[model samples]
Target: MIPERVLLTLDLPDEQASNQLGEDIAAALRIADVLLLSGDLGMGKSTLARAIIRAMAGNPELEVPSPTFTLVQAYPTRVPIQHYDLYRLGAPDELEELGFSEAIRDGAVLVEWPERAAEDMPKDAVRLSLSEKGQGRTVSIDAPVDFAERLQRSLLIRRFLDDAGWQHASRNFLVGDASTRAYESVCRSDGTAMILMNAPRRPDGPPIRDGKPYSRIAHLAESVTPFVAIAKVLRDAGFAAPQIPAADLDNGLLLVENLGTQGVLDAHGIPIAERYIASAELLARMHMHQWPQRIEIAPDAVHVVPAYDRVAMAIEIELLTDWYLPYVTGTPTGDEDRAEFAHVWEQMFDLLDDAEKTLVLRDYHSPNIIWREDRRGDDRVGIIDFQDAVIGPAAYDVASLAMDARVTISPELEAAAVDAYCATRARLGVFDREQFETAYAIMAAQRNTKIIGIFVRLDQRDGKPAYLKHLPRIREYLSRALAHPRLAPLVPIYRKAGIL
Candidate 1:
């Protein structure tokens, strides 16, 4: 026998409580959701719907009237909502004429008196019931199993914001990169805006080798501790990491300052050479300093930066053979081929013996670098995505910028940026041009190899196909990097493997 589904119940002591609940739900609203609200007349369904529509529109004063007479009212909000009132319906078949199914296809739907047409509702539709209580009201939500956790998390964020003194802030979802973390832009009535980072602790996958997950071996930041520690350090060191206004470290939530919307890319999504050079110069200045391996989030909590050792680099390169090569050629790799690939990278790792080491922001690419024109000098480069930092070759970041992961970098522009970085380093101290040259090429190839596999894995395993569009660019970047004379030993290997 199957168990009965459990519904989440909440008590609303006043209109403010109901509004907050509605706002929280609105924040997590997605296209194709059917919010079936069931309740009697005067049970505050309209009030809750109004709050949700207003929150989604990002305008608290937006007019949202009852659709009782019209049958349905569509609002062009962030997630377009179709508000429906089946109370005065002539028949259940009228829902088809009212465009209920059509609304579900285009955007989210909120329906009152859904029981009038219960058969028309989708199986996955979220069910909400409102009823009167002692001097207040109670709401019970029964979401589809898959959506229940997301609803709880969004509500938790609402509570977090309220506790952090941001009760009046309006929320709008912010698109993030290919990561599990989510972001929201919260603005107050006075036009004060801040970013809310919802970074939950991700569980590790099954151990692939030596009883450790790839995340652990590759030194991926499992919690926000690295971010908090690095942000404080970057701010202290005269960089542009966002300020943390409030934090719930235990719950993996943080309210951060809003760095400008501008990034290293232009309006057309192309890399700006001038801005790239400026960012490179900033990196030069960063490498000149002797950064510590241990970063302090608080006096009691310290995060130790991991070293980018041969093991870590080798594991990353394996992605090419494990996922990317298989995807590109549509053939599973044999043990012999995998062993040869590992051998090639192992031999190439020795070229970095004399490479300069510093705090390597592993993903120092265009997407992570914000261009703040209002600031002067290095301050213009606002670094926001650096949780996966490591104590590694300084040349890695320069390569990451010059041979960007997401955008195409022309050879002329790449050379100019590298020249700017070298010039800036020369001005500060005696720079090792020869050593950096080889290290940059090796790091570039390794990064692209890993990226190629990650993109394939994202599409195949994670069900995100957008990253696949960048595979050709990544392949081109890899070929360019592999051309460096320092990597000649592995040239034939790449050619033989059909990955060149």
Candidate 2:
């Protein structure tokens, strides 16, 4: 029996509406998710399944034949989709012999004739019931509560796209990072593709420190306004931030230009030295410019960039005491140690008072950088995803690049990237190499410490254990940063925590 909870009951008045629903489902699909398509014969079940499979594969013309004789067809898309037809199943128990369980475990599954193996069919799978209504069909979707909300959001995205005049664009899931935002690539009829960013307003988490949420303390972007404002700022500075063509400011949806797929990393996911150097050069070029403290994202709409003050920086480092330390030491950090850690970090921040200040794109790392081979010089680097930018020391972003949080950079490459940045800055104008180096070491250490804690929190609180594997790299980066003589006083604290 289907549960009382029904996500949506809509009429697929035409093939277009039905195909749009299929695209929506594919966009919201997660790994190991199962979707049961149920309907009477000729209810367009196969057509909807083909629509879904093609959307997931990002190929509208990919051949998706019925899996009746073969019983199953698996396409190795990014999330991997498996199509199954059980209309001719001899017995319910035989479902297992067809590798049904294994297929469901590996990736998303779409099953037709689920009733043939009703006893063996997974109970938690989302169910779609379609029935003929005159010349069209109506569908009732029953999904788990959390998934139901996701579907509702996906439908909202469709409406947003429709309002933007791209009603029939093909959708494909791009990437959803460790943030609240999700992204999709929508291809128009003319073959132009754009990024559809689904960054809803960030809800505040429970007040963790100083009666403010972690996002507020960290100066994270709470709404799409920041992204729009920051994008304008970067583009005005001559950097290649994505051009936002359409924005539903109230709804947190945007259709942006598709920056090319190439990035600073190679096919093997390792950092390319030349691209890294070019990215560093881009940062140096950006730093030499004077950014407006308040940017006009739209006429009469201004966004003021927040200052990355000591409170925010210090509170960020406390993630070490609050999350990472306890995970490693088997004990919650004492208040005394927390106080000392905060104090040392505050003192380090004091050094930044004399350092040059610029727009610190809080995450100037590899994931957000797009490499354009066709572009010239610094234009080769495309910067995206910097809604949390702040007015801070010039060295912070340099540190973000040198001690990349996602991938390990060899010592030689790190030195080369840093030197390339220094050379670029020197040529741009008067540059203080010594001061920048001092701040780089301290800021790099501070950022790495916060990342180590965040990775642990992602594992423990967010149920994402994959981030744990990067902990060692983060720790090593932190140690390398702490080795700086200017940060010598803070080394003892790390040593006492057995994190050196």
Candidate 3:
């Protein structure tokens, strides 16, 4: 379902007049679930955003900075706003690379000059248009389909005006529920407003399975309890963790404090290497934390990757052998290669069994970490996507980061990070440092192999060719891991497949 619809035509006398119009827009925004400002140059798009921000906080000095060059800017407010300028975008694929999806989750996003980014935006987004009309200005607003009733009932609008010491302006404005089930709007009788979100729910990703089994697993309540408990344990240890304010355990509905962007993977921009090291240090910290007796794995607890079992592993391998191999090279895999590949997988499994295991973030890569400037020390890394966390080999997460299945980390940076992580482990009381390194190498090789196969599948089966773009980098990581003596034995198999 999409949001409500509201169309408003505003006439402004001049650039300065846009501020008062902005104030009205801000007032309208209090009730509106999301506000979209669209206009051309000299049309005062930024001015309108500033006024709304000012009106929301009733603080005239609040800066509504333009995100034109930065791509996006997130304001710190009781109800935060995310501003985006997509005029300079070179391509739609750039959205994922720039991390726009994650930003939308944390706060309301406003985009200026959005024509180029139309393809990258939400399908049912609220749209607005601004144009220069001689000395005056004209503004047009279009709400998402069917959002009228909800917008009119929006709690934020009712509370905002009340807080500003005003009576309930008619409840005539249209509104809708927060974009996702995780977010809920709450406004008092006054105009004071804030959005409450359920922290337990992670963003919905590509469906990993089909039918009822996956359907049951996708719901927040079924999936979030374990991770919430895990975060509580981390929080007790003085780490920054997701806070769960309220939840119906059976239903999965929740109200949570918005933590803002502070995840490790969310770190970006120049000095990228420095941000990576910081994330590495935080992972090391989590790895070194002594597992408390209270947290025990239930025998029936589901595996993070449901398909990680023996049968699933075989199916994945078959997908590589039968589908990926032929499609990529038009050369069918021989029976002999299949036998050797299975044997190699078995050997890798044995090595995994032998390694000293620890808590592992099953998917520890970019797009999960939130970056915040105010955070102190290692706590700056706001880790998310831990619902699938597992108690597995210490090297699993390290491998997940080093041979990232998503973004590539340069060899030099990866080496420095591994060293840094190992050093942190030593400081945090993990002995047998050499064993950890060896385990790390073995896991790196194993993880990258699976990723290489998966990338091929993403392209061939899922029709996502973008993954192909990163295969060479994954190969590079595999080459580096193979260089380590511990993984030297497996290099030949990969080389045979032309994966090197």
Best by lDDT: 2
RMSD of 3: 12.1
Superposed Cα deviation of residue 136, candidate 2 (Å): 3.2
Show where candidate 2 strays beyond 4 Å: 1-4, 13-16, 61-63, 69-82, 91-107, 117-124
Model 2 agreement with the true structure over 411-446: per-residue lDDT tens digits: 888899999999999998999899989999988998
Pairs in clash, predicted candidate 1: none
Instruction: Flag regions of model 3 displaced more than 4 Å.
Output: 1-222, 248-256, 262-271, 292-323, 331-336
What is candidate 2's CA lDDT for residue 315?
A: 76
Across 195-268, the per-residue lDDT of candidate 3 in tens digits comes to 33333334455555553332234222245566656666667776666675444433333333445543444345
Q: On residues 1-500, what C-alpha lDDT tens digit does candidate 1 reach at each position?
A: 43234589999889988887888898778889889898888889999999999888877789888888999999998889999998899899998998888899999999999988888788788889999999999999988765677788898998899899998677877765677888899987788999999988867978988999999999898888888888888888888899998988888899998889998888999888889999999999998887878987787879998999988998898888889878878899889989888887888898787788899999898888888888997688899879899999998999999999889999898899999999999999999898888998999999988898999999999878999998888878878889988899888877876767
Higher-scoring candidate on lDDT, 1 or 2 = 2
- Comparing 2 with 3 on lDDT, the higher-scoring candidate is 2
lDDT of each: 0.87, 0.89, 0.61
Whole-model lDDT, model 2? 0.89
Of candidate 1, the 10-residue stretch with the lowest lDDT total is 1-10
Q: What is the TM-score of each candidate against the true structure?
A: 0.92, 0.92, 0.54
Which residue runs of candidate 1 sit more than 4 Å off their true CA positions?
Answer: 1-4, 13-16, 30-32, 54-82, 88-90, 93-107, 133-136, 496-499
RMSD of each: 2.5, 2.5, 12.1
TM-score of 2: 0.92
